[model samples]
Target: MKQSLTAMALCLTVWLSIPVAFAGPPHGGNPGRGGGGFFDSTNEYRDAVSLQDLQERRRQREERGFERLKQLKWQTGYTMPQHYRSDRYKVDYNYYQLPRPKHGQQWYKVNNDYLLIDDDNTIIQVH
Candidate 1:
């Protein structure tokens, strides 16, 4: 009887502690809503856009990534930030921006690393 009681207590403890060991996302909603999510970061109103459209945008960006990066007017609206906390956009270049996110595949810098992000805010490629 004592052994059975101990086993039950142990099982209960493990069940309760499982959440702490592998906690879910903070928001507890869709895990891929913000940050490095499966959707677009610029898209403030996720309700308006359909999933198919978003997927299509990502595909287009991946296909035309090279052309878009080459045509970027780097000297125009882009400028090196005064301070950066993370090396998310590291690159060899001195100038860095917090990703002027656009509608298609865009090139960015994150700590000596060149990143190519798709419309879905997915890192398609990196250099």
Candidate 2:
């Protein structure tokens, strides 16, 4: 009876070890998702995403922003055109404070055109 119990325990141990052994990094291959279970495919994918393509994409975005500034629209109720003017909105010691306009008037500019927007998002003046 003791020999039978020992054999049963040994069988259970071997059964549990089978799955655990296969679950680890298979053979000499990496367990990472980027690799094909054995080979590193990261460099291949990284090279595919060329630097020239990324630079060109950034240049296009910059050009688009410059174009938007050049062509200021008569759009009212707009939250804000450019995020770079955030300094003007905030009271920072480093940035120059914009002079206050008439009561209840906030000046917003896209490019060279200055738009006077009121508190209620209404266009008061466009120059």
- Superposed by TM-score, candidate 1 places the C-alpha of residue 8 at a distance from the truth, in angstroms, of 52
Model 2 stretches astray by more than 4 angstroms: 1-52, 75-85, 89-100
Global fold similarity of model 1 (TM-score): 0.21
- Lowest lDDT block of 10, candidate 1: 76-85
Which digits, one per residue and each the tens of the lDDT, describe model 2 over residues 26-46? 445564654345455664576
Task: Give per-residue lDDT, candidate 2, residue 40.
Answer: 56
lDDT of each: 0.56, 0.62
Candidate 1 structure quality by residue, lDDT tens digits, 70-107: 45443323433323223454343335544454556566
Residue 15 miss distance in model 2 (angstroms): 27
lDDT of 1: 0.56
